[model samples]
Target: MDGEPVDARWGSARVRGRRLRTVRAHAFAAAGLLLAGCASMPDSGEIRAVQASQGVDSQVRVFGVPPADKATPAEIVDGFLEAMTSDDPQLETARKYLTPAAAKSWKPSSAVTVLSSGLSRVAVRGEKDPEGPRWKVTGKKLATVDEHSAYQPQTGAREYEEQLQLVQDEDKQWRISTPPSGLVLSESDFQRIYMPVNKYYFAGGTLVADPVYVRQRTDPDSRMDPTTQTVQSLLAGPSRWLAPVVESSFPTGTELRTGTKSLSYDGQNTLRVPLNDKVGNIAQPQCKKMATQLLYTVKDLTGSRLDQVELLRSSDDKTSSLCSVTSVSADAIANRPKIPEFQYFVDNEKRLVRMKLDVSSEDQQTRTEPVPGPLATVPVFKVSSAAVSHDERRAAVVSEDGHGLYVVSLVGGGPMPAQVPIGRGGKAETLTAPSWDASGDLWVADRDPQHPGLWRVPGGTGTPERVQVAGLDNRRIVSLKASADGARIALLLEQDANSRILYIGRVERPDAKGDVSAVSVRELRPAAPQMADVTAMSWAPRGRLLVVGREKGGVQQARYMLADGSMVAASLPGATGLSEVAVAAAEDESKPKPVVAYSEDGIVWLPPGAQWRTVAAGGRSPVYPG
Candidate 1:
């Protein structure tokens, strides 16, 4: 009874005149009943059968295992590399191409080198031997995803090569006996199997998070639990690219408690994480901070399944609560200062004026008047760029002539002073815009190629001191912006070919008190490699960067990019021919932070809807208080 009418058309045809009309009506009613029956829900057995079919189809590996009996050494090596792309739970299918002992000892989590697509090659080294044969694989390396799944731009070696040793088992089957500890995959495969996860760290003594890519497995029985793996990676600390800048509260050697199986969610959707004895020594404040880190990391992995984090400390075969907290109270552990809602710029009159940001309104327009201050009375000439202090009471400005750097009080009482000289000749060859750090120190870079270097002044006063920047030799710094967190600095360097590159360097201060003698810059990492000329850049909320630049064959545009070199397309339709960009990094949760740029048309702003609204005509440099 598959809910279909039986011979209704025949009945209508056989009936005569008036009887025929009635017969057709009955046939129509029967057809409606048939459709109604078909619309009913399927039985439990039928539903289960459909779900089973879908599950099996999804479990099919991306790379299939090939018969090894007739495969060559080079073929085995290629197969093993291809198998790394599979999402097979424990990678058991990948293990089939490896010798039993090698498979057991191999650690794919050690590292991952993302190779350029269509550039990989495998070569057999020599003739086959009784044990097996050897092969060499090489490709162009794009980036390195470390053990913690943190990505770093490949700096030195452009080409990657590895030696693979294969052996034949008793059944005469080819298998990899001595493969590399880590795995290599194509760029497309890496994107398909991995996702970005941010790990929180403290910057300028305030809590902040940095993004890193982590592998996401589809198999329920995968060897590594994604939730637990994420927490462990966070404890491992920031990537090499960012470690020098950010600080992690977690002590060295922190790990999950022994005998703990996996991270689990309880009835209330709270995540219970039991850690080793190392956490027993952490103070109450630090314990809560650690809990905050765990909460964010786990929530990102499990989505809304986790509401809070309950940390348990294991000792004497017993577990006890270290701390428990939610995302709401996490701010109590952070010492971040409030950022101003107004945007400031030097007017055509050479006076400083601010425009208030009304994020609530549909237009999101700026206020009409500027705040009254000493800057209004002071005569600032040809201002190229200005950086507002963290307190919003002071500003540091650089002159267009590239000679003088001056600090001026924003509140109306301070005396108008002379320009701070940057070099020995009472003139700077070229001076970058000055930046104020949380500690009230001002930093600038001298673009003099003969003696190119970075300099720091105490609160934008006193004699400038040279800072040692590692790996900055032979490159000219065109622009510099110090991050509000005070842990890193963004630099625009000009290469020999006249191409501009964006780099982030970790700022290291001296340990000894009053030791302004020297500061070190280390672990420099590239942020935007595709841009041929970067006109301007600024830091955005959550450690992202707002960059304005032109690609090789593209028009100039502004876009957001993560610290790990991932691009986020923020549409600014009317913002073209942009010269500079700035962001408030507003802490307000109720409204979207405002971003402004100086386009050829005028000063344009991009608000919540990504629409470019004009702020002022003929405005040059736009900035927000740190």
Candidate 2:
């Protein structure tokens, strides 16, 4: 349904009243059945009658239809609004209360305003102009579902007021003529009619997907298909807020081969996708990426009904030239470069050590002694945090005093030179841990409240340049991590009252120069909004995030969250007192990888089995090469 603001006080009483009635009804039904002597021997006709009664009762729970032709203007408006909550395909019943012209033009799915229960009320002003009448709707707006169906939570008590205009038809029936383009539904109806799904996009040069909620027809035979809608929405590109940071492999102007036709499946449970000619020019690598995006998106929407996707130039094409794609883990996509197999962490002596994974062993344990880094031999300032470059040949270190950032090569046996300085020179109040993007550039936030800014330095010897980021005014960046693909950057922002918030932004770089010029930050919903502080975050496989934080009055904890802010229940429960977290994406998409976290006790690791194991007695700042 389309937009209207929600009222916090709306529908609550109604819901409670409904629940009471349901409990009473069930109690009475049970009692009646127990008292009936033939309850155990009820005839087929009797059972059918009881079932029919239940069906009617369920329909009544959703509210009955509004008055028809003889209904007043207020009645018609109320009925139309109520009808918006129905599961009728195309909202055909909701249209009955509108003029034919208005019915044909109204677009209910454009947006949705979710309101609190028991607080919505309509006020009707008499027919001032005789030719038309107007009504006002007031409520608290909890969140808004935009055209792309992304649910954005409102920051405060958002009260909304809408003016609706109505006209009379030739049959003398009152009807709404100028209804709002979007729909307004109670939170309950929204949950029943809408679902959240992720659309794949490339982040940090890797194929990752972000979740966006979309409305789906609840009817069993509606022409509107959720799978087709999802595919079309993905082709439409990422939501406006995320567009700047994520890239879509789909070519411009690409669309389903048959427009609105529902996806078809073969006997083998393979989805057949037909694409327009826009994809004809895409190179094989890009085509595969596109296929991967579609596969994940469609699989999510269809409950994994199809195991593979076959792309055709057009629906009519029967030739073998069409591309076929099988279901594979997101990690298997060829676009993302391979990460180094070794894990790195800082030891008690402030020295970097590497633990190599035994790929050939069934246990996948690190049996060899931890190798000290080449930089350990060189005299350097006390290190607080470090980031390994994407190529695994270099590392960036932040001084313990948060005054300087330095880069050191990790390869070669010769004594290493002093750490190379990068970024603005003067001492700052706080310097976040450094991060390396795909281009080998180093990024770190200078947390000087008076002049807080983000900076990018070239992989080699260029000076660090300040990068302007929108929507970061008056806030200190606590920590920053750039996605391996270089498309998105995640920042831990410290706000007033020691509140630590997480934000994701798009990174814009100059075409010729490798330095970043701007970053665009967008509001993000975290999986754990109640967390009082966010200590660490890292990108994981399948577009998930490994977030470590603590709720107010709670112990430190870590959880996985999808890009759209939904919590993933994938277990990693036993580890505790985590100070830093790291994840390594596996080469095989289907294989689960362990997540390493540095806790107060030591270096604790959570493998795929959700059990924690100690890797070292005194380690901190664990990391996997980007």
Candidate 3:
């Protein structure tokens, strides 16, 4: 059964009111399974499609078949490999192909190796084994999801090889004696089995999103639905890459009520979560924060809109409600940055200009006006790149020669303040660009080779301090952008003249009583490992980045990627020849701000569901308030 031809092809079935276009092939391997476990398949036949009705929801569902009696060693190996990709709740069907002792010891959740294609199995020609047989499984690895569900993309296709040993049971039945340490799945199978969800944690006074992959349906090992699994992950604490910069509201030993396998929202769209005794004494203020985290973490799951989250204390007799928070109340506790009021850019006159966000292309000939106050009326230096404060009251601009940095108030007319002391007037690479965080601190990178480092302006007013960035060995920071939450920062590092990579780093500050001067950036993680070169990137809504770059040997294009570096979340529609891009931070996700880009044709805007249209004829840099 190593290379036997398959008998089944793509077919259709009705499951609950939706139609399923069943996938019966895995890459070049013949890995087909039936919806019902006991259904019999053809022994030998050609693969062909089975026609079915259209106009129904097209969802894919794959199931596994149990091993047959008196199966051969090769057949058992093939059956087990295919079963690993099935919809087994606990992977129990796949374990049937293993020896009783081996099944008891194997742990599938340890790690996940994602391959570009299905595994190819071949018998070992000369290996002598005490067991019945030996087989080699090999494939090209694309990525790996760690035990923490953090996804890391491999720079290139890496070879994956493992050996499987088989033995004969007491009844003379073939079974796998030694199995792989963890799961090995194809790319398509991994996407179908798991989905990315953002688990919220506290970074200072604001909530930060940490992306992790969880099973879409009931987890095979935990037997918990997606909602319950997400809550447990949140209680487990932040991922290792993000742990140093964020904190969780839940108590250290907190967990769900004993034997809580599933959670659901009531008819009023309120979810009641029962916690263990560890949280029974939690204060009202702290309990509200815990519920706020749960409300945001599980909001992406498939269900009705969640209006509120109620926490209850588990007891021997009856649980008592600890605290509750509605959507409106939770937003107040989250403390997100204020939404931007207008989009800003440097126009043809080399002066900063503003345009109302409410004006769309449909409106005839939208007018552009210079920003209020001294930066526009009084001449200082030609504006090149700029960053607006979260409150939309102050603007940070870099001179055209990239030598000077200035912070000008958008309101109250006055002379532009003197150039920031950190900027050294000499060459174009002296300063990259400026970015603001939620704490009102300004961040910029000085690319001067002799003294290159990241600089932070305290509250956009106080003395400039050089920030210590760990893990930045000999890499020059060309550009930088800070997330609105102030916990994460994205940097474009120049490894060489040809290679530029994008990385997301955590911003860490000293404890309350510790030295306040010890603030630093830590643990820079790759945000776009698959892209060979990254030219530009901006922080988008919900802790994602809109990156403009290209893969190795490919043309440049714009795509949106999760900050966790898992996978490309989306591609920018109709985006081309982009040199710079900016996205407004909106509080209401349902109505997103238009995406602005600086292209060869000048500044262009992409309204939701529409083509990119020219906004400013000679605009060079476009930015929205951070």
Candidate 4:
């Protein structure tokens, strides 16, 4: 029926010669028959009219226990329905009661289109009664759909020719429509209903997350009753929606907290305290709720759909909680958490809104054998990021899984050094660096493929456009970070053979027409002559570069240049963990000293002097807020 049949054998097997000549007359006859059949098609329009008339037929009569003349409408309807479907031993129904044809209603082939969802239409129709009286019915439906979709009335809807309907027949004493064998199975009872939709379906829909629970309604031939939708709306209706959760602090259901400490970000003051009541399926619910709101805001404010969020405790670098907007990343083949995966966040007011976790696990049983007697092994981690607002008012940390990003208050003063994604994981390909602007609108750390520029997110709530440079040598970039003044953007990119390169660039904001551009500012490389693959770098507020490397000497300060590289100055004693140290220009001019941070001997250390004074028995990355 979908198409026509072809010759069983093409080319040679097609009819020819005597066969073709003999078949022309038969084919002609068949065509004539087909044409005749078409010409003789019945008047379905008239049939439909008759069927509609039957809905209120005056000729039909019924003999039942109830007296027709005295029976009430309800009683008559009940009796007729009984007779039409009579299946008892005392009563039997026959097939003669049904009309030969029935009116068929369906969606209109040519219907109105919907330009938008907000359109509304009102209609009032009146029908004349048998006594020259008229009855009117008023109704309304979405008018916008007239332009976009095709909808229809119920299948059994009919324009009645006879005036008497839904009332008792004087003879039959019943008001029931019947099928063949007098069965009361007509389509009149099956009325169409409305579509069921909730407020979240319209307001909370995540355009990028694209959760599977959401979908468009396209039912030219709907299988469900339309009234159900109206009923649902009546029940739940609309309201101001609830805000999303952004931050949280909790322990897993498997473990309970005997001691939970509320700490701050001070390198020396932040510590863990035990809580006795924290147990299975039992977390700090208030904290978790706050975390959820913070995390969702991270998405709205930052304008990036993330994979995971985490919450970490600084005491032992444990993951206290975790969250992710999406279950996993797009390229994730199985279950692998990528690095730079967790994001740290902040709000417009410079408050820590979101946090990331920093947790790790290693098999101490096997590794212990490699060390000497009384040897012990433990895992460690660094909470990578927490997203924030443009003004840096609020901040949050994301877990390695990207599930939930927890909100933290850099100002309200809650637990300090709180992380989001708590579990341990490695680096990944997409690291959306969170940024805050003067207005509190969020921005992202994005890569630039063209001209090796920095992709800084413009302030607003919309799709992020990539900012580019005119000329440079770079490709396949993945990470980014912007300066405090919004002047510079630092980028970490993937190079040949799993290597990485860092580049700095300046930004040019949009004009009255709204456009942006980036320019390379400068480059940071090994200041040491040997320069054995520097791992990372940080810019001090005092305008100095904190570079990391595995050089032979300690306090290897030097003037770095792209053309010639760095020159080592001197070496100090007992500085073995050079690779684990991160340096920053010393603050407090009265006590100006290079802030040296490193981890060793079950303790994180941050020394104040250029000679490594070991200020904190356990601390790392002692950030001095600007």
lDDT of 1 by residue, 321-413 (tens): 988886667655555545575777766665556787775565433464544554555363456667888788778877666667778877776
**TM-score head-to-head 2 vs 3, winner:** 3
Give the alpha carbon lDDT tens digit for every residue of 578-598 in model 4: 433343332122233343334
Give the poorly placed runs of model 4, Cα more than 4 Å off: 1-383, 387-393, 402-409, 412-429, 432-465, 469-481, 511-532, 550-576, 579-598, 601-610, 613-622
Single out the weakest 10-residue window by summed lDDT for candidate 1. 35-44
Question: Between prediction 1 and prediction 4, which has the larger lDDT?
Answer: 1
Tell me how many clashing residue pairs each candidate has: 0, 22, 1, 120
**Two-way lDDT contest, 2 vs 3, winner:** 3
Model 2 lDDT at residue 65: 48
Whole-model lDDT, model 2: 0.63
TM-score, structure 1 vs. true: 0.81
Best by lDDT: 3
Off by over 4 Å in 3: 1-58, 125-128, 154-157, 359-361, 364-367, 512-517, 580-590
TM-score for each candidate, following the candidate numbering = 0.81, 0.77, 0.87, 0.28
Model 3, 1-626: lDDT tens digits are 43343222112232211222334355537655443323112222332222322211114444567877887666677778767766676788889889999999988977888877667777762224554477777878878887777676665559988888888789988888889888887776677678899899998789999998887778889999888988888888888777777789899999999999999999999999999999978999999999999998887786589999999999895788999999889989998767667888888888888887864546512667888878767554478888889898999998888888999998998776898888666655488779999989999999888888999998999899899999999799988999988888999999899888999988887762243657788878889977898888888878888888879998887888988777788997655567744433333353588788888877778777777877778777788887
* Per-residue lDDT over 1-626 for candidate 2, one digit per residue giving the tens place of the 0 to 100 score: 02333232333433222211222344567575322111111111222222211221222223224345477665566666666766666777677777788889988877888765323445455655654667777766667878776766665667877777877777777888777777887666666566678787876556655667665643322354778778878988887766665678888899876544577678997877778877776777777778778887877565546677777675345323356677754337735645566777777876667776543344433452433455666573357677887677887877666667777777765554455444344555367778886677788887765567888787644677777777776677787777766766788877666568776776665641244544433444443454677777887765566777777887767777665553342435763655544433332234455677777766666667546667777767777765
Model 2 weakest 10-residue run by lDDT: 35-44
Ranking by TM-score: 3, 1, 2, 4
- Poorest 10 consecutive residues of model 3 by lDDT? 9-18
